[model samples]
Target: MLLLIVMVNSCYVPSNLRTVVFSSVNNNVCKRLDGDIVLYAIFVDSKFTNPWSKYDIETTLDSIRVATEWIEQKALEDSVDVHIQVAYHKTLQGRVPIKNDFSKKTLSGTLYKKPLWSGVRDIYKWADKIAKEAGLSMPRDTSPITNIKNDLKNRERLIARLRDHYQTDHVALMYFINNYYSDEISATFDISNDNNVEFSIVSFKNPSVIAHEFLHLFGAYDLYLTQYDVKKRDKKKKDKLMEMFPNEVMAFAHRNLSSLNISDFTKYLIGWKKEMPVEYQRLLLKKGYFTAKY
Candidate 1:
C-alpha cells in the first residue's frame, strides 16, 4: 500500500506545480525567483569516429560549463534557484559520416543509419538547406531538417524512458550536432518532443539557442516573426516588436554571450512576475499569461 501510494504520488500532473512569481518593492526592480530549475544535457557521441578524444571531451565539457554559468547568472538576477544536471551518452550506432561532396559519396555512406522518430524527414531536409545556405560545410550523411525532427522525436522518447525508469519530474535539454537539413533547425518547443517528455534541442554550434527554446518550455511565446503577411497588416498597427520592449530576449536570438539579458517581458512570460513590461504585458495578461492554469 505504501509503495502504491509513493508510485501514485510520483506521477506528474499539470496542476501539481504552482505558478512562478516575481516580486518588486519600492522603485527598485526586484529580482524574479522560482524553485530549483533542473537541466539535463544529452550529448550524442556516435557522430564522430573518435568520440572520446581528450580535446573533444574537454571542449564539450567547457561548452556545457559555459552554458550552465550563463543560465545560473541570469537565474540569480531573476532570484530563481537553478539546479543543472548534464548526462552524456554515446549513440548506439557508430560515427555518422560527414557529407561534403554529394556526387562522391553513396546515399548510404552519407546517412546516419539510426532509428528515427516518425515525421522527421521533412525537418532534416530543412535543416540541411539552411546549413548549406549559411556557407557551412555540410555533414556527410545528415540533413538538419529531417535529422533534427527525428532527434527531437528520439529526445522525447529518451525523456519518457528516463521518467519511467526513475519516477521523477525531469525536464530535458538535448544537445546535438545539427543534421544540416533545414534553416528552421535553429530551435523548437513542444509539451513533449513526442509523448510524455518535454524536450528541446540546442544546435552544437549555437549554444545560446537552447536558452531561447527553454523559455518556451517555461510557457513563453515567440516574439519574433518568421514569415510575415503584408496584406493583413495596416501601416498604423504594425507588429510593433521593435517599438516596445526593445531589450527583450525573446525578441531576438541570443547567438552570443553579450546579447543575453533577462528582460521584464521574459520574467512575466515565465510567470515570475505579476506586472511585466506595459507594452506587451497587456496582451499577455489578456491571453491569461498571469493565470496559473496553463
Candidate 2:
C-alpha cells in the first residue's frame, strides 16, 4: 500500500507541473476578420567590423522577403489586406563588445578602446554608466554597453527618426552580426531591442535564428525548449511535443538552408495569412526541402 501511494504521487507530480490554468476566456482576439494590417521591415546598416559578405546579406534579405511573402499569401487566402514595406538603411553603425562571450570578470575590467571597436564598445559602456548614475539597476549578466534600457532608448530614437522620415508606424527590423554573447543568447529580438520594431540580430552562423525570433513578433511562442527545467514542467507538455518535430526552419538545428519548413504555429504568429498574398504562402510552403506537418 505504501509503494502504490508513492507511485501515484510521482505520477501526479508531472501532470500537476504540466497543467497551466488561465482564468480569462479565450477571446480569439486574433480572429481573421479585421482591417488592413501593415508590417514594415527596416534594415539598418550592419555596424560590426566584420562586414557581412554581399552574397550572405543578399541571401539573408531574400530569405526574409520569402518569409514575408509567405505571410502575405496566407493573409490573402483568408481575405486579409496585408501591406508590408521593406526599408533599407546603410548608415546605422554596429554596437560592440558582443555580450555572453567573455566571463563577468573579463567584462568588468576590460576597457574597450579602438577605432571601430571603441566606438561600438563605448556606446554600451556609456549606457551602463548613465544608468548607474541615474540610480537604476542593470539586469544580471548584462554589460553596461548592451543594457536593455539604453538600447530601447537608442532604438526609440532611431524609430522616431525613421517615422518622421517615412511618415508611418512601420515595424522596424534591425540586423546585426555576431551579437551573441557566448553562443547562449538565442537569435532574436533582445528585450532592449524592443519598443520601436521587432529587432532581429542574426549572426552569420545563425541566420535562421532571426526566423525563430521574428515568429515571436507575429505571436508565436517558442515550441522548442532545449533548456527545459524539470521543476517548470507542465501538463500540456508543449515543449516536449515540440521536440518530436523534425529539424526544419522552426527548430533550432537545421544546417542546410533548403531544409527549412515554416509550421502553422509560425504562420499564426506573424499574422502572415491576414496580411500577405496567397501565392507567397504556397511558394514558401512548397519551396523548402522538408516534409509538411503530419
Candidate 3:
C-alpha cells in the first residue's frame, strides 16, 4: 500500500506541473503583463537554389538573435521575462505538394493556385510533421485554439498537434526562405486564438519588421494606412489614427527600432496595459473604428 501511494503521488506531481506550466505559458501570450515566456521557432529551408549565400543565412540568424534579445530587454523594462528558442529544421524543405509557392513571381503567370488557404494549410501541416519527426514536444491543449473556421480547419488542427508535441501554449512557426521571393513581408495569423508568425528570408533579417510582426501575434494592429490604396474604405480614418500614433512600432516598422515605441493603444490591444486611454477611445469611436471588443 505504501508503494502504491507513492507511485500515485508521483504521477499526480507531473500532471500538476503540466497544469502550472501550460497556464503560465498561455497567460504569457494571451494576457501578458509580466512573467517568463518561451517562444518556439521553426525555420523552414527552401529546396530550390536561392539568393541567400552562406553569409546571408548567418547574418540573418544574427539579426534574428539580436531582435529577440532586444525584445527580451524591452520586456524586462516592463518587468516581463521573455526567452525565445529558435529551432532550425534544415531537413524540412519549404515546398507544398501540388501547389506553387505563394509569391507574385511564381503565381503571376500560369502557376496561380486557387483557394489559397489550402496551400497555407499545407505549410502548417508540413511544419507539424517535421517537428514531430525531429522529436519536438509541445503543449497538448486544444481548448485555447478558438475562432477556427472551415477555411482554417487544417491550420487549427496543426496548431493542436504542434502544441501537444511542444508541450507549451506559446509557439511560433516561421517559414524561412533563400529565394528572391516577391513581396518580402512578415505576417501573423491568429487561429483559434493561437497566433503564428511567418516571414520571408529578407523580412526575417529586419529587426523592426520582426518586432512589428511579433506584436501582431499578441493582437496588435497596424496603425498606418497608405492613402493611395483605393481598397481602403476607411483610408481617412486610418490616416487620422496614424497621426495619433506617429512613432508607433506597427505603423513605422520600416524605420529603425530606436525611432519607434509600442503605443499605449497597442499595449491595450495586446493586454499589456489594463485600460485603454479615454481620449484614444473617443477618437476611435468618432472615426467609426471603435468596436465593442478588440
**Predicted structure with the largest lDDT when compared to the true one:** 3
RMSD of each: 14.4, 14.8, 14.1
Candidate 3, which ten residues in sequence have the lowest lDDT sum?
A: 1-10
In candidate 2 the C-alpha lDDT for residue 151 amounts to: 38
- Superposed model 2: Cα runs more than 4 Å off: 1-49, 92-153, 178-186, 190-198, 205-208, 228-236, 243-249, 252-294
Candidate models: Cα lDDT each: 0.41, 0.37, 0.48
Which stretches of candidate 3 lie above 4 Å from their native place?
Answer: 1-34, 47-54, 90-167, 179-182, 191-202, 226-233, 286-294
- Candidate 2 achieves a global lDDT of 0.37
Error of 2 at 35 (Å): 8.1
Please give, for residues 58-162, the per-residue lDDT of candidate 1 as tens digits.
565567666667767777777767655554433344322222222212222222133322223433343333223222211222434543322222444444334
lDDT ranking from best to worst?
3, 1, 2
lDDT of 1 at 72: 71
Model 1 accuracy (lDDT, Cα)? 0.41
